[model samples]
Target: MTFLSGWGRTAPTPATLVAPRTAPELSALIAGASSRGLIARGLGRAYGDAAQNAGGVVVDVAGMEARWSLDPDTGVVTATAGMSLHDLMLALVPRGWFVPVTPGTRHVTLGGAVAADVHGKNHHVDSSFGAHLRSLTLVTADGTSRVLGPGDELFWATVGGMGLTGLITEVSFACVPVETSRVRVDVERTRDLDHTLEVMTATDDRYRYTVAWIDLLARGSRMGRSVLTRGDHARRDELPAGADPLAFAPSSRLPAPPWAPNGLLNGLTVRAFNEAWYAKSRERRVIQDLAPFFHPLDFVDGWNRVYGSRGFVQYQFVVPFGEEGTLRRVVSRLSAEGVVSFLTVLKRFGPGTPGMLSFPMPGWTLALDIPAGQTGLAGLLREFDEWVAGAGGRLYLAKDARMRAELLPVMYPRLAEWRKIRESVDPGEVFRSDLARRLSL
Candidate 1:
């Protein structure tokens, strides 16, 4: 038995791991799955139980040989499920093309991106990854390989279904054309929560990408103080003379220690780090490589270990535009309580995808990494969940680990529709995961 856990390194469980090199191989394995059932896994970046099967079969798609083809004229790429964005960038960036949307890290797989409908800083301008997908190939419970697109109900269901509807084998998506793999970024530090919100609300539309790193521990007048970074892809003319404008080599990663003591990221240490980080910022405009600009943490391999042996919970939720009060309340409460979140981010989301369960909506999203073992954490988060749901907001399933199943229908009104579609395609419920079982999805 192979034990597997999500990126958070929490609630690990044992399962039979299998790697199928081809679609037929995957389909055959599914047909022979035991009563425990099976689930598809790619790159294991869900941050929660979405990618785990717990005693069932885990189809590790990442082990499948990477394959992709790009059409430079249309800037669309058709790639197998196993291909990672990092690999895609290495091949496309030098050719003056870029993925339409990328999350905080490029280590995620194409199939996982579709399953999560991943979004990024540019969500205000562009939608999540699903918006760019032209079509996807899925292997259903009955071992039938089907190709689906926007016109198909099953396609929308699988887009953000967390890999429950079926196993996504391949996908074709549009790529953004770029003159350089660099971003011209503007950085500014806000004095307080109101100022931060005001600046973002006023100027976010002007930039193609924008995000704010909030210091959740900052209280009183400085509560919600943030470092705002906004930018767009740099044009070729903006580059220094003779520079390789399309250069796409990312920096090598430095590995984190194999283990860390629990509570290593206590409030004191986190507060100190937040203060230094906040103070270190100054209003400036500079050109930065795409890797550093979009995926800074990716430079530190296994940085989650810093949260220690108990692991961490990545709580990410979004509240609609008019419900800014709820957003303010949550941030204020966390700050007042001196809750230690080593990494806190706030971003504005634009229109959402058609996927029934896709997380994004037109609103403000806040993501925090808190220690799992923190006192009163569960109750506090559960309270926040009620506030979010009451405000017509919902949490991101990809990052969720400990939300109540009772609230799933409330948070996702389309849950019934999604469930109907899932049942239609997977009536036997052949596709199962710890997340599916946990939330009754």
Candidate 2:
């Protein structure tokens, strides 16, 4: 038996692991799954239990053969499910094309990205990954492979369905045309929460991508001080003369230590780091590589290990527009309590896909990483969940670990619809995961 957990490295459980090279092999494996059920896993970047099946079957598809072809005319690419966004970018970027929407990391697989319906800084302009998907192939519980598109109900169900409906085998999506792999960024250091929100709300429309890094530890008048970075793909004219406009090589990663102490990232250290970061950042406009602009954390291998052996919980919740009060309240409480969040980010969301369970909507999203072993953490987060739900906000399932089952329905009003579609395709519940069983999805 192999023990597995999500990227957070928390609550690992033993399960039988299998790697299938082709759709036929995968279908056969699923058709014969035991009562314990089965779940698909990719690069395991889910941060939570969405990819884990305790005492059941966990299909590792990252090693599957990747077959991809790009249509240079339409800027569309069709590829197998196992292909990672990293490889996809390496291929597409050289040809002056980029993925329409990318989350914080490129290590995620195409199947996982589709399943999660990930959004990035560009969410305000491009929406989530599902919005760009043209079609996908899914292997159902009955071992039948079906191609689904935007017009199909099952397609929306599987889009952000957390892989409950079926196993995704392949995907096709349109890519964004880019004149250069470089980005022109405008940075602003805000005094406080209100100022930050005002600046972002006023100027975000001018850029294709925008994100704010919040100093959650700051209190009093300085609470919610943030650094907003907004950028777009640089045009050919914006680049320096003779520079490679389409150069696509990302920097090498610096691996974190194999292990860290439980208190490695405590309040003191995090506060110091936050202070230094906030002090050093000044308002400016500059040109940067796409990698640093999009996936700065990706340059640090095993970065989560810095949170210590006890692991950490990534809390990400989004409140609809006009609920800035809820966002402020959550930020104030976290700051007042002095909870140490190693990383805190805020982004603006735009329109959402038809995927019933997709996490994005027209709203403001805040994501942070807090040590799992912190005192009163569970109760504190539970309180935040209530506040978020009351404001009609929902947590991101892809980053969720310990959210209560009751709030799932309240937060996701379309839960019943999604569940019905899930049942129609997986009646026997052949597809399951720790998350599915945990929240009764």
Candidate 3:
């Protein structure tokens, strides 16, 4: 059996990995695998076990390199699931078109993005990835390929369903138009908790994309202070006089050292880094490229290696709109307790798609990347789950690694409906993943 793991490189497990270069080959493999279950894997960017299925057959769809075609009149693009957002951007950006929604990283495949129903800095304005999807081609356990759309229950289940429903073969969606690949940004530094909340509430809608970088190491009166950045796609006139109109070059990236020590990111080091980051962001109204603005971490190739071999876990939760107080309480608790998360982001979401397990809602969402080796990290996240459920919030399954199965139903009120659809399509549970088993999905 071949061994494969997700992007996090944790919980490595053995499986029979098959790379079928075409849709027909993928279908034939699934049709032949009646005894062993199958899970579809894309660029393997899921930060957890969502893409890993132990002792089963894993299908890697990344090798299916099919190009995309656009419907000029409607701005709709149909592409194979194996296409990466990075590739899509390069093809569409020059034509005054952009993806409807993009997650923090552009390395994600189209199928992975849809399976995870990824959301981005603009989630508050444009919901999750599912919200923009027009239709999809799903290859079910029985080896039949079916077209699913907004009106179909199976469509909703597959979105944010973690690939349990079926293997997505193709995706069709409408793209947003943009004048240029540059971003006209406005940056603001907040002093404390109250100031952070106040600034976000006051001016978030003025920009198309918004996010806050919290100083998690701060304590006492300065706890929860953050640097907020907001921006909209730049117009051609916003560019400098000598800037190239057609070519937008992204900044170069430095790769992380493969042999970096495990203790390189301890409290003292993170605190110092946080201080320097906060001190340097005092400037406002910065002009930046779309790559750096939307995917700063992607600039550093293999940056996830910074967390060492233990990998890391991203804890993301959203509390309802009226429950901002509960959100603040949790942030305050994390601050007072000194949890030592190197990256903390806060955003507001609008509504969500009908995907039974979709992770967005009308609320405030916060995501923090914590090294898995941190003491009591698992237990602490479990505790946070309780607070999130109490406030009618849920964790993002794409980023989840250690959530309780019992709590999943509480977080996602539509779990039962999703399960019904899943069971109908895959009655024998032939399509499964480590995440589906862990969360009882």
Candidate 2 C-alpha lDDT tens digits along 204-246: 9999999999999999999999999999999999999999889
lDDT of 2: 0.94
lDDT of each: 0.93, 0.94, 0.87
Q: Model 2 TM-score?
A: 0.99
TM-score of each: 0.99, 0.99, 0.97
Candidate 1 residue pairs in backbone clash:
none
Model 1 C-alpha lDDT per residue in residues 1-441, reported as the tens digit of each score: 999988898889999999999777987998998877899888888899998999899999998978899998999899998899999999999999999999999999999999999999999999899999999999899988899999999999998899998899899999999999999999999999899999999999999999999999888888899999999999999999999999999999999999899999998899899889988889999999999999999999999888787899999999999999999999999987778899999999999999999999999999999998888999999999999999999999999988999999999999999999999888888999999999988
Write the residue-wise lDDT of candidate 3 on 1-441 in tens digits: 887766666677888888999777987887777555889888778888888888898888888867799987788999999999988888888887889999999989999989999999898888889998999999998889999999999999999989999999899999988877888999889998779988888899898899999998798889888999999988889889988654655567788888667757778988999999899998589778889899988889888888888877888999998898888788887877778787899998988888888888889999998876777777877888999999999998888878889998899988899898998998988898888888878
Candidate 3's TM-score reads 0.97
